[model samples]
Target: MTAVQQPLAPHEREMIRDELLRSLTKLERSLKSSGAAARPRDLEQDTVGRLSRVEALQNAGFTKNLEAREKAQLEQILSALRRLEDGSYGACNGCGAPIPFERLQIFPETLACGTCARG
Candidate 1:
């Protein structure tokens, strides 16, 4: 038996889109505040001890990795927004099935239905 999928209501879609926009804005602000991409590690500073320098470098690397992940998520959210604009937001990209509104609520940037996602 196939599960029937319902299209998201306009109100539901609007809510999700608003949430995505808020998330995107928050992430952009976070990325800007971190300045991970432009930050330079000054290893030669006389006031810094060797262990402190190593720890600082490690932290910087971790911060950069987090920034990259956040940027990727932002891109996904943007893509989902585009899909909404194109009237394809609630449809699975894999099997061309409609995605459930509840699932979309839990994962606003999903591109596929649960079955296609599992496969």
Candidate 2:
């Protein structure tokens, strides 16, 4: 009998998780610091206050978006973890077929085979 291959093995998941965690950590720090850094200056207090307000708003928006994406990615990783528990990690979520190992290597969070993914 021929053995089927995993789209992403344990090592691959660990690598991707490391990358995602780094990005998420960086984004979190930026989000947390943007408002603090936007405080008005003493020399140009009036203009600085206005600019700070705008900067704070923009930073909040970016942080919100980044956080949302990060949460989604985390969920995807969690699903992958569950699949590992169930022995179905590499199967496409859409059509229940085995996702190609190559595709999983490139995108560890993949939910479908290429054909199903295209649709």
Candidate 3:
């Protein structure tokens, strides 16, 4: 069963927004630093063995996946911030219902209430 949600307090909303902003900033910095590390190295000029080159390629692939995931998360955070601006934060996008405070506290970027999420 889904619990009815009350309107979120201004303070609570601010706290969630603050957390999201901090997270988004940190992630952006981390992605920038990691970008160079994720690129393919100059395998032709390097004296590294074939095995080592393969390993480097594998690591680069993994880093690319990580970057993609982080980018998706950044987009979600931005979307949440936009919702906050439009007076739609703490509400489900699927059903137009207020989301539970506890859920929002745990997942400030959520766009669906639990019941709508389950379906």
> What tens-digit string does per-residue lDDT give for candidate 1 at 1-119?
13325557779989999988998999999999778554986778798998999888888888888888988998999998888887778888789889888888889999898999999
TM-score of each: 0.87, 0.62, 0.88
List the candidate 3 regions with Cα displacement exceeding 4 Å: 1-6
- Tens-digit lDDT string for candidate 2 (32-107): 6654554543445555677686776686677667656756776776666556556666777777777776777677
Off by over 4 Å in 2: 1-47
Better of 1 and 2 by lDDT: 1
Q: Model 3: which residue pairs collide? A: none
Put down candidate 3 lDDT per residue, 53-96, tens digits, no spaces. 88888999999999999899999999988877877688787887
Which 10-residue window in model 3 sums to the lowest lDDT?
A: 1-10
Sequence-dependent TM-score of model 3: 0.88
Q: List the candidates ranked by TM-score, beginning with the highest.
A: 3, 1, 2
- In candidate 2 the C-alpha lDDT for residue 35 amounts to 45
What RMSD, rounded to one decimal, does every model reach?
3.9, 5.8, 3.8
